[model samples]
Target chain A: MSEKYCIGADVGGTTIKLAVISTEGEIVKKWEIPTDTSERGKHITRDINITIDNTLEELNLHKSSILGIGAGAPGFVDSSTGYINEAINIGWKHFDFGVELKQLTGLNVWVDNDANLAALGENWLGAGRGVKNLIAVTLGTGVGGGIIANGEILNGANGTAGEIGHVTVKTTGGAPCNCGRSGCLETETSATAIVRKAKEAIVKEPHSALSSIKEITAKDVFVTAKQGDIAAQQILSDVTETLGLALANLTVAVNPNKIVLGGGVSQAGDQLLQPLKDAYSKHCLPRAAEACVFELAELGNDAGVIGGASLVKQYSNEQ
Target chain B: MSEKYCIGADVGGTTIKLAVISTEGEIVKKWEIPTDTSERGKHITRDINITIDNTLEELNLHKSSILGIGAGAPGFVDSSTGYINEAINIGWKHFDFGVELKQLTGLNVWVDNDANLAALGENWLGAGRGVKNLIAVTLGTGVGGGIIANGEILNGANGTAGEIGHVTVKTTGGAPCNCGRSGCLETETSATAIVRKAKEAIVKEPHSALSSIKEITAKDVFVTAKQGDIAAQQILSDVTETLGLALANLTVAVNPNKIVLGGGVSQAGDQLLQPLKDAYSKHCLPRAAEACVFELAELGNDAGVIGGASLVKQYSNEQ
Candidate 1:
């Protein structure tokens, strides 16, 4: 039997990342293509198909040597059918991207939410390697999460199983959220939320170092905190305290082997992790706290594509 | 080959309920035996073994006719090995109950936490039948929970995946929980918590209907609320509002098809269900709220044993 390869594509508003991964979990080649949002992303799947054909031809790989396609999209995706119910960023609504790609390339396809794919990728090759249970949280523009339980991603009853961002952290008098909820984990802990907290903290500490900057980022907060700015340290404390409690509560529910922290805010690294761990240890069940470990996500920008490839492998095995 | 049967035992602090169930999910005969907690429950498994042997002889059924035994015990049980790490109620610090039972009876044995067993039973034949994802909550003296995701019981890293009771709700300045955490869902919605709320409400409403009764119970609060007692209604509202929010948060994480309400407090039925649904609908993500439903558990006290039988059946299929 010839060596089998699988294609993984991560579709985003800016660009689509594609990777050719071997069955042994090595990325043979990887590249990116611009995403066409015109006409409701109709050309998106076609463009992906064209790129795969061109790439295979260039590499001298036959269709039989490729396993399948695994795609990750932003939206409420039906994992089994790769149907996008709604992806606001790319303007896809009720689109069958997976089936179209499969037909175009003559291979099986699996699709999942981008956040879920990132979790799968991290679990397979990053911080969660060798562990069957993991929870991956992405602290980017918005807080997103993926839960891997008993070695499978949990998509819940409505394909929203890992909606960790919406987990209500504040019971009352919380800031309003985009989801029309109040006091969500996203409201207090996302990178955007950290900037919002910094803006608010500056109002109280007008003479602080952060007040001098016209615009502040989460990274700036970490740098300023390291320089002994009280306002920045307070924001870090508040965010990690809230995030720590929420993650602890979540840990008790799913009991993952490790929690992989990724995205923009996690770049702060140990500055964010130490306080969060302290809060988690204080709040989490002693048994679960002792058993579970926390680590930074290692795959970075490649996690989604890698996870997509893994999806194809997992589905192929099931078949 | 003659039809084979399995034994299911629900071990409690006071009694052990045993049942003979056919592989087709029918309970043929059921009975109970007093649990011997003397000597740190050392003789409990032996007593159960002797009883099983006597029951088989009395019914003229041979050992070969039985497939295996499935048992449910209180506390932190390692499901795969059936090792009782620490069952505080049964006085079992560290015991291999499953191995002892299997050695004594010459049959395979499977053991799991009792709350988890109830969830399995309910999902297998009760409210969650035909649903692959389910959450079962027990509102007894204390709160207990079990999660079934993708048709398998989720025993996370250290066997505590469904500790829904400990999900932090109050967040700060709330009542302390037995788990050394303050403001847990269990601190607000357990049967004991309901009575505590009722007592506190009666003090404020001195002329209310609940003040006339001594030693108030959770059932009393339900009955009085139905009879238009303002104080009782207030207690119901407070408890359910907290429970509704907690369950709504939990639903977002696991996304179960059905949330089964079991244990003593659930006997309040519609009085509890209507308010909980209203609050859940208010707090849950609209898509998830529409996809999930709440139901009162059907198995009641029999849920544990029935779930144990299901465990044996499930383990048998895996083998």
Candidate 2:
């Protein structure tokens, strides 16, 4: 009971999720606040500090009770130095993010990329809980991934170790991606990619249910495919195959214990997972395929905060 | 002089390279013996044991003067158990390799995939030395890669970590690889792939210099390209671009401090490296690219033995 807690903050473009987490990896309390976009994100840290202070006072906790603060931000973060190179939505560039937060709250601060933290969070307490090595793929607007090896986040030399979305599935020809690459896995597997594929498929097969939807969504594609729409089914099949090839290729390189699929598109569950696994098995080396299991990410939106807490916990242990 | 030494062995399809390596990683003495295939690889460990004993006796050293034996073999190796799932060249399937060696020599034996050890060797003392993380790619008959993270080999769930050649680069149509996949990085980057590309180009452009050579080799392609052969140059360009994209994709996943290019094709020197780097820079996220350097593998053929010795050194430290 006398043990200390740390604050886990997941900073997104629109909102910041925060949690009071026990050193033992449990979330004690959680809340969120709108991100302060005014002044180009200069007030964001100050707002975070105010929230932390108010929360401590409300819980009748002493300053000493909080060990540190860990924040997961959407950018290239130098985790060792807590520097964020760039985050367009939050308007941060070349900012010493950790220092600003520490200056406001007088508490230790740690920062890492949001996706990397999500991987860590999933490895720590989600579906990949017991696995020492895993790759967590988030399939939303963009395909994002985090790699965990030896139960630690793999931040590579430039803290971009787990950019799975950028793994090129097709080199000669495919859709262009935001990452300035063509044929990236993200261009095929992201929610955006799914909707695009559905829209394209509707044009090719006008009689398909997807043609009726004016604004085709990722969910609409999956739901239509489930209803036996040939166009939707074909789109899902193509995306799943792309996802499989990406995962299989990653498996060949890293050979993790598990591949955890997350993000908005992943909620399609068995419909998405079964085909992906089958394709992975087909593409992967038999030995690597036999041992690795593919599973849905369990943490969902909470991965960032939990992963932030895990980062703080790791740093505390190191200290 | 009183310090002990360990034996390092690199088992291959034709011959087994062996070295009496100092605990500090220097090759004290080295030699090789033809791989015994008559008894279905039953005598491999025995030959290794005899070689070690004879060398120790010739040096007037006692058994206590040696630490242990480390061996690197081609296959899916269970480093923890020293069991090889399959090594086609050695005819080993579900073989308990370490136990057989240990029973003969009464010394601890450690075995891992040959490429993985080569990566360890390079990471420990070759071009990747002083770097904590690296991915060593060998562009030989088939592309082989080893991933080193936190100064140790990353053995994935099935001990198949660092299998970079299998990374799929083309999804729709490409050359079929031996690993039951089409459009693998190996299909473009391997020395075999390079020769194949050149030969196909020669057939298409019959007047090109490549048509004169009866047995078009990878070195021939590089040399002819260097001599202003446009056909050969074009082939190299295509291959390097493919290599660059593949390496760039991998860099996005692991972000190692160094990417060490090894094997026969890498000997092409700047002709291979410069274009590869350019392609990598083009495909990679700028942040990851900034922190990673590409270098040629310095160890060459010696990498296997050295890496085996490194494994034993690592085990000794762990003990």
Candidate 3:
């Protein structure tokens, strides 16, 4: 008898990553496919189906050996009903992705918010391993967060428990956010926000080295700041400061055992971590601040796929 | 054998309320005693000891039949350790209220924040009885909150999980708070803030009826506003608006089944609830806003004692 494996799929705007993992969380096979989110919601489902079929064939895994499929997508998901209420980036509104996938592949499917999957992934096998209470933050295009408490995802009544990106960070409203709110934490600390602020700084200080770059990203700002570019350094400092303040507020509210930092901007490593820690310490209530440990995410980009697989396994075991 | 009952003690700065409740959550007996919080920390122990003795005698119950005692106080409490860490209101730091009480009465004692106790009380026997996930807001001199999830109180890593009073409601700093932070949610939406705003409004509108009063309380402002005083009404509106916005942000994060309002100012009832619901609907994500139900707290003053009793029963059962 062949070993049973579960398929985990992470669907994003530009690509989808899929992985096949055994019951013990070991990856047996993995692959990726281009995501056609340009055509709205139609192509995403089609793309996922084709990718799954190809991966199973390559792995020579029979349908009987495949336990189930798990998918993590960006947006508000009704995990209980397997429905996506809205994904502004993907232009999907109330799409029943789970039902559609189940129909196309004849497999049981479990779906949830991508950030939440990443948090679970980290908790099960990555940085948050051995910790029952944790919060994972992804400082990507937008600030995303996932919370795990008492060994379970903190999915609030509407499955929006870990929407840390939308929490208010600035007491006075600053720039507007994509979520139709102003002064959201994402407006100041996300990778996109960091770049936006850097651009503004370069425009104001044309003599700086950062102004010479064709286009500046969060990475560019961090690299230049490290080499002593005063303007870029200031931008990096401000971003971390804002992030720290938000984390401090989060510490008081969630009181997690650990906070894992992931996403593209977190790749800057210590350049970001040290400053963020200082800010968190300065702002958090003394005891909670001391109790929380901040660390870099170990799963990196694979967190979504691993988390998706874990979700499927968890769902099946419960049933 | 006679059914066992839990004892609840609410230790406030000026008063203490005690109640004996059956396991089924019925209040079998209750009483009140004056608390000399002004006499430093020692008087608190004396007051509690005297109250418990008198109450047990009055109810004709022996100490052997009492299950345990749960205490609620204003401070940072290590619920597991039963230690009160720095309660500025009572001018005590690192006070072992639980150990002392247990030694004096020869009964187990549990201690937690007063607001959290009220929330637990409501969850067990009041407005939030059937809801597993909810947030209880106490709008008094200070804004305090308690979160109940999955039929248990959410005491985060350092036991500070439900401090919604400190959640940032204003993106731009509002007013200075006693917590050493500016623009905290409590600074803008607390009963004290409402009264301060009312006084400011009276200054701006010299002819307003509220201006005639030398000193103003949240209740006084509500009454004058109910009589159609423009300044008082405007201040009250601002208070509700801030509260609604705060609730909207909190709903996004907690996705609670309901938000129960308590404390002194909550007595305003519909005058506060209507506008708060409207503002919350306008500001919250549509799905989260629709899922949350807002209501006035049902436990009233008994919430403290009842919640305290519930805590003891629940904790002991878990152990």
Candidate 4:
């Protein structure tokens, strides 16, 4: 008997990462291709099909050897119906990615919000492996979250259960968000916000090393703050405090056993986690604060791919 | 075969309501007793036992007909361990209400948060009936919440899943809350907050009729506002807006099929709901907002008792 395999794909704005994993979660082959999501929905679908076909061929596996295919995309998805309701960045609306992909490759296809897939991946084999209840927050260009309860993803009534970034953390409506909402958690703590706020601060404190840079990023702020740049440090502190406030609110509301932090900003590690933990404990209800455990995500960038692979297993079980 | 019955109790800070319910969801008989939770642990047990005995006697039923009993209390409860972790108002900590009640009455007992029980009751027989995914918010002295997903109460890993009152809607930390947190949803929209904010406004706007009142309550604020008191109306608008913001956050995060509003403040009806719906729609992602439906709770005060009675049936099926 030969090993069974499934194809996992993570489609992003600029590129698509594809991986073939064995039944035991081992990646047998991996590849990537530039995604032309801007051209048309058909072009994007064709690109995905080519990647899957090439990956399987390189691994000496036929299309028949694949069990199913799972893909994670950024947008509102009807996982049950396999429809992409709307993906603003990709310029797609109500696109049946699953049906089109299945017809293109003659394979079963499953699609969901990328953050949820990442959470599933982490829960199955990463930081949240042993936890029965967990919430994963990703701090990239924008903040995103996925919730797992009793070992299952909570998709809620409309497959939007874990849209945590849109949660309001500010009453003053301090910042504008792309989601057309004011004072969202994402507006305060996302990497984009951190960089934006840092650049704005540099104008006032021209003595800071950050002022020398043409453009500042969250990474620049982290490095400059570590070197004792007061402006950089202040911005970092603000970001962490904002994140902590959101964490406290989430801690009280969800009361998950573990909270796993992921995405680029999370790479700052303890610089982000320590202050966040302090603020979370200070603001949360005593019992809930005591019951929660916070940790850095272990899966790193590969979480999305691994999570996409895990979706095949999850969907199979559901069926 | 003999008819099966269960005893359901709703233990509030001021009163304990008890009912003998048949398996078919009928309240055969019910009674109420003053709760002396002031004395803490032992007194609560004695009071609960006496209430159960009296209710059973009034219904002309014997202990042999009782299948089990369930109680809902205002506190952080460890439903699995049958412990009331904390009841701030009652000063009860780490009290095993279920164990004591079972020992005294010789019946299997289950215990949980009162608000959660109310949600369960609503799901079983009230406005939320037939909806597998729903959240119920009760706006009384303090705001409370219950979450039901796929027909089961969402008691998070630590048995604190549905504490929606603590979800921060305001980033500025508007007012201090009883839970030692700031800017909690309860601090702005609860019945207590409605009255407190109204009294402050009445003092400033001395020309208003509300200024002549010796004391203001949530009911008084709603009534005075309806009668065209500027101070009262302003407070009502603030309360409705705050509640709407909280509901918008919840709707985005959970994407429940329906949100049922209950408790004293909800009695303001469309005066509160229309503004809340507008704010919620404005804040939520279009997809999630479109999928959600808001309604007033149908169970009223007896929702707790009915929900507590249904717990036996709910858990029995789980086992």
TM, every model = 0.98, 0.94, 0.86, 0.91
Q: Please, what are the lDDT tens digits per residue for candidate 4 over residues B168-249?
A: 6565747888877677889889988887787778669989888777767888888888899888888877777777777777
Error of 2 at B282 (Å): 2.6
Q: List, residue by residue over A159-260, the lDDT tens digit for candidate 3.
A: 787888887655465778887767777888888888888889888998888887877788888988888999988888788877887777767666789999
Cα lDDT listed for each candidate: 0.89, 0.86, 0.84, 0.82
True contacts kept of each: 0.71, 0.77, 0.52, 0.58
Residue-pair clashes per candidate: 0, 0, 8, 2
Give the per-residue lDDT of model 2 (tens digit) for A1-319. Answer: 5988988999899999999988888788889999988788998998999999999898888889888998988878888888988887898889889998988899889899999988888887898886888999998999889988766778878778898888777666779887676888888888998888887777788899998998779999999889988888888898988888778878888888898988998899999999999888878777788889888999989999988888888887788
Best candidate (score: TM-score): 1
lDDT (tens digit, per residue) of candidate 2 on B1-319: 6988878899998999998888877788889999997667988888888988898888787888778888989878998889988888898888899888988999888999999988988887799986877999999998888998766788878788898888777765779988776888888778888888888888799988889998889999999998999999998998988889878878888898999999999888999999999988887777778889999999998898888888888887788
Given candidate 4, what's the lDDT at residue B149? Answer: 68
Instruction: Order the candidate numbers by lDDT, best to worst.
Output: 1, 2, 3, 4
Which ranges in model 1 have alpha carbons more than 4 Å from their true place?
none
DockQ rank order: 1, 2, 4, 3
Runs in model 4 deviating more than 4 A are: A1-6, A46-67, A103-106, A170-175, B1-6, B20-24, B33-67, B88-91, B103-107, B169-174
For candidate 2, report its TM-score: 0.94
Which runs of model 2 end up more than 4 angstroms from their true locations? A170-176, A199-208, B1-4, B60-65, B172-176
**Candidate 1 lDDT tens digits, A1-319:** 5899988999999999999999899888999999999999899888999999999999888989988988999878888678888898999998888888888878899999999999999977788775788999999999988899999999988788888898887767778888887888998999888899899888888988999877788899999999999989998998998999888888878988899999989988999999999988888888888879999999998999999998888889888
Instruction: Report the number of the highest-DockQ candidate.
Output: 1
The DockQ scores of all candidates, in the order shown, are 0.76, 0.68, 0.44, 0.55
Better of 2 and 3 by lDDT: 2
Weakest lDDT window of 10 consecutive positions for candidate 3 chain B: B165-174
lDDT of 3 by residue, B237-291 (tens): 7877777877776676667889999988899899889988987776676667777
